[model samples]
Structure formats: C-alpha cells, structure tokens
Target: MSPNRATTIAIGVGAVLLTSVAGYAVWFDYRRQTDKDFRRKIRKQNKKVSKVVEAENSAKGARTQQDLISAIIEISQEPTPTTPEESEKYFMENVAIGEKLSTLGPDAYVHAATSFYRALRIYPAPAELMQIYEKTVLPPVFAIVKELIGIANVIAQQSSRPAEAGIDGGEGEEDEEAMIAALQAAVAGAGRE
Candidate 1:
C-alpha cells in the first residue's frame, strides 16, 4: 500500500498494544497494593509464601487421629441426588468445592474431605475415581478419603452378608479389615512425616 497508509496502520496497532499494556499495569498495581492475599500468592516473583500452604502441611501432620470418621459420617448423611444427570452435576460441584477448599488451610481439610467424599459416593466407578484421588488429592485428604471408603466397604459387606448369611462374606470381611488396617497405618505414618 501507500507509505502513509502503512504508517497509520502501524501507529494504530502500536497505540492499541500500548493502551492494553498500560491497563494491565494499572490493574496489577492496584491489586498488589490493595489485595491482602496478593502478597501470599504463589508466583515466580512472589517472595512471601501464604500461611495456607503451611497450614495444609501441618494438617497433613496432624491426621494421625480418627476425627475424619465423623466428617465421613456427616458427609454420608447429607442428601445426594438420585438421578444420573443430577448425580453428575452434584459430583462436579463437590469436586470443585473440594479443590477450592484445599487451597484455604488446615481448618478447611475436613470440609474439603467431606466434599470429596460426597462426590466419591455418587461416582460410577469408585475405585477408578479413588485412583485418580490418590494421584491428585492432598495426602492427608486422600488418607481420610481412603478411610471413608474402607468404612463404606465394611458397611456394604456387613449389610449384604447379614448375620445369618455369613458363609459367603467371610473373605470380603477379611479383605476389608486388612484394607482398614493398612489405611490406618498409612495415616499414622503421614502424621509422623
């Protein structure tokens, strides 16, 4: 095109880029100045680490006890959706809530675990979901979730076996007991760490 037209286009593009950069700088500066939690944000440039991270580690350290049993029980008591579509939606929401709560601190672990457990209950393939949890969930939270699953399995075994039909369920009970014991040991070891 003409020289003047090319110059005008280049100037327009440069002005647009410059304005966008200035807008971002103002936003970043305002947040850095006014947002209290901004200082604790985890970034390459962030110097101060948040207490939430410390609290999460401490929470993992303090998971030696059986307090999570009550949280699991409470989660089980909460109403769950019956339909498949509703269950899917519920599962997504709980997982999101669990992830959000996980970043908060130690105090939120129980609530986070509760949310995860709720989602786990409605999942189509619980074992698969649990495997995913083992990889992605916090160690302490995963331990609690494993314990919850162990308890659920034991309960399922008990109900299906019944008091009189104890013949077929013996192996299941043995396996469940072993799993529960292993989970308990793992949790205790995590606390020692």
Candidate 2:
C-alpha cells in the first residue's frame, strides 16, 4: 500500500473515533441532567404529600373552640373578687389560658381571643395592671386574633369561589390584606378600653 493512502485511512479512522466519543459524552450529559431534574421534582412532590398527611393527622385530634372554652371555665372556677389585689391574682392565674390557646394553632384563635377578652373583663383597671396587661397578655391575644382573621378570610374566599375553579383560587390576597387591616384596627380599639 502507498504511504499516502495509509496516512489518509489513519486520519479517517481517528476522526470517526473522536466523533463517536463526543457524541457519547453529549448523550450521557443530557441523560444525567434529565435524571437530576426528575429526582428533584419527585422530592418536591413527596414533601407536599407529607405535609398533607401531617395536617390530616393533626386535624384528627384537634379540639373545637367550645371544648377549649369549657375546659378553661372548668379550670377557672374561683369566685370573682371585689378587691384589686384579688382581681390581680385571679388575672395572673388565668393568663395561662391565653398562652395555652395560643399554642393550639390558628384554628383556636377565636377561643384564645375570647379567653383573653374575658380575662380583661375581670381585670382591675388600675395603672399597674394595665401595664402588665399590655406587656404580657396583649401580644399573644393580638397574634391569635390576627391569625383567626386570616383563617376566616381564607375560608370566606374559598367558599365564595366556584367549585370548578378549585378550593383556594389564589384570588384572596387582597381580601386577606383588607381583613388583616380591619382586625388590627379592631384589636387596637379593644386594647385601649
């Protein structure tokens, strides 16, 4: 065979091998990227499913507002006092009801708010008591009330929508904001009195 022909054949073989290797690398990279994306999507879906299951489990054991109120009333059976010192003591004893209700999550906010309001009703109107009320009791009550308002707004929006459009239509952002503003105003008014 001629040297020139042998050299040409060698060049052709080298080119074919290089092209095959490049093609295989590109295909492998594409497959790897696709697999990574699929795994990420599956992880996200699993997280969503787990959250739904957790909510369901929690709801199974959740207590109603009436149940909470009844429990509070049962625990707080002390007679109403006429003296300021006794009233302060009574308020201090029942303050834990608000804290407990606050821990019950947003579903129990109405009950929590009611408990706080009741505590305030019997509280002595002295200046020192007012400071304690504002500093200690008001924040958790306000927070629970705010959460209740938000939940109510969400429910109202969901109920008002057409069933075909799905439960949470994502159109209640504005309504939620307006409701929050209203709740803040109402809470502030209640706090002043």
Candidate 3:
C-alpha cells in the first residue's frame, strides 16, 4: 500500500479508538451519577419509612390520652443531665418525640406540647446551648403549640355551634380564647426558661 494510504488508515483507526474511549468514559460517568442519585433517593425513602414505623410503634401501646400523658411524663422524668452535651441529647430526643406526637392527631397535641415543654425545661442555661435551643428547637415547639391552639379552636367551634335551631350557644368562643391565651403564655414561659 502507498505510504499516504497507510498513514490515512492509521489516522482513522486512532480517531475511532479515541472516540470510543471518550464515549465509554462519558457513559461510565453518566452511569456513576445515576447510580449515586438512585442510592440517595433510596436512602431518603428508607429514612421516611423508618420514621413512620417508629411513630407507629410508639403509638401502639398507648390507647388513651391518659396513657400517652403518663408515658410522656415518664420520659420527661428520666434522669436529668449535668452536662450540656447530655442535656442537648435529651432535648433533641424529647423534641423528636414531640414532633412525632404532633403528627399523630390533634388529640395528642397536649402530649406533644408537654414533650416540647419538658425539653425546654431541661435545656441548659449556657449561652451556646441557649442559642442552639432558640435556633433549632424553639421554632418547631412554637409551631406545635400554635397548631394545638388552632386545633383546640376548631374543636371548640365545632362543638359550640348549635346543631339545631333554638339550641343554646355553648361556651365555645370563651373557651377557645382561654385555651389560646394559655398556650401563648406557655410558649412565652418556655422561651423565657
């Protein structure tokens, strides 16, 4: 074969090899990213499932509000910590329980609020711990309190509204206002403490 032809063939082969390598590299990178994303998604889903299961398990034995309250009180009464780290750990656990209880239903709101309150009560008075509590813990606790108040208001309204004509208007409005005020006071107290 002519030298030019041989050179041309060699060039073509080299080009094909380079192109194939580049294509394979791109494919491999894409697959890697896809796999990473899939794994992340699966992990997120598993976390959600585990949380749901935990909530269910926690709720399984407590059939009544009194039982739930007793359980929460038991949790709150567990040994207090002397160190900030232990305090923070317990605070987080209580907050998590409160969050889970908040999801159960409006009936559980009191227990949820109590849990949050216990966390606040146990929180260390140090500057750093206070800051962390204010930043990470306060918002959710306040939110739960507000939610509880709202639910109470709704329940009061539903119950107080007359079902039939000429029925006496129940003590709905006053009770709702009182509950809201009490909740607000509790939240304020928690913030102060």
Candidate that would win on lDDT: 1
Task: List, residue by residue over 97-192, the lDDT tens digit for candidate 3.
Answer: 977887787667667776765676676553454455456544544555444334334434433553422224335767544543443444344446
* Per-model TM values vs. the true structure: 0.46, 0.32, 0.29
**How much does each candidate deviate from the true structure in C-alpha RMSD?**
14.6, 17.7, 16.2
What local lDDT does model 2 show for residue 28? 73
Selected candidate, larger lDDT, 2 vs 3: 3
Ten contiguous residues minimizing lDDT sum, candidate 3: 61-70
Model 3 residue 114 CA deviation (Å) reads 1.4
Worst 10 residues of 1 by lDDT: 161-170
* Clash-forming residue pairs, model 1: none
TM-score, candidate 2, is 0.32
**Could you give candidate 1's per-residue lDDT for residues 22-125 as a string of tens digits?**
99999998998888778557353343345667777678644633455445535655787989899999999999999999889877877787789899988999
Task: lDDT winner between 1 and 2, please give it.
Answer: 1
The clash numbers for all candidates, in the given order, read: 0, 0, 0
Error of 2 at 161 (Å): 30
TM-score ranking, high to low: 1, 2, 3
Once fitted onto the true fold, the runs of candidate 1 whose alpha carbons sit more than 4 angstroms away are 1-66, 155-193
Predicted candidate 2 versus true structure: per-residue lDDT over 83-127, tens digit per residue:
988777767655667668777876665566656645655765644
